[model samples]
Target: MARILLADDDEATRDLVKRALETDGHTVSITQDGAEALDTLTSAAATFDVLVSDVHMPGLDGVALAKRAIAAAPDLKLLLMSGFAEELDRAQALKSANLGVIIKPFTLDQIRAAVRALLA
Candidate 1:
């Protein structure tokens, strides 16, 4: 089980992901946007094992959030989601052993698998 921080603008997506991960026994904390997610991360007393975020958001985007999240917690694992090819490409620069990207409209299994891979 892992502690997961999930951020997305869409309520359905957020709920879907939170439930999906929670079913796997992970403790999930959700946020509506990148800015809120970052705030939660920085303020959290306990460290989260993973961050699952949507690439696009109102206040701050996932890519920027990822960068700051890593700086705040170097060991944190990241999974960035986006439907746009360009947005996915932008995240590629941040790719590493601890980072991954998932195309949006993903099946529940796909997202679960992606997070599992990061945890692994």
Candidate 2:
């Protein structure tokens, strides 16, 4: 099973995604804020196969976190999710970060497929 870091500001959304990923047999570590997510990635004990994060948050934000995380862990697989696809598209950092983007309101099937594809 792949180890995944799930970062989202919304508690409900985080819970939903976490349950879905866990149900698919993946191990998950969840963080409710972008800063916390970054801290986890930078932590000495932090290790994960993939990172799934929301694009917008109070601090740091997903694209910034992904960029920093990738800098620290070049091989880290990143999957970014957002309700605002337009905003994500406009964020040049996201494109430069080279991470996969999943539009929000995704189905469990979509999440499972993304995890499998990334892990594969």
What's model 2's TM-score? 0.91
Candidate 2 lDDT, 1-120, residue by residue in tens: 989999999999898889999998899999987789989988999898899999898888888888888898988988888889675784445554346778888998898888787777
RMSD of 1: 0.9
Count of residue pairs whose backbone atoms collide, per candidate: 0, 0
Which candidate number has the best lDDT? 1
Q: Poorest 10 consecutive residues of model 1 by lDDT?
A: 38-47
**Which pairs clash (backbone N, Cα, C closer than 3 Å) in model 1?**
none
Candidate 1 regions exceeding 4 Å error are none
Please give each candidate's TM-score.
Answer: 0.96, 0.91
Give the TM-score (vs. native) of candidate 1.
Answer: 0.96
Report the CA-based lDDT of candidate 2 relative to the real structure: 0.84
In terms of TM-score, the best-performing candidate is 1
Error of 2 at 26 (Å): 0.9
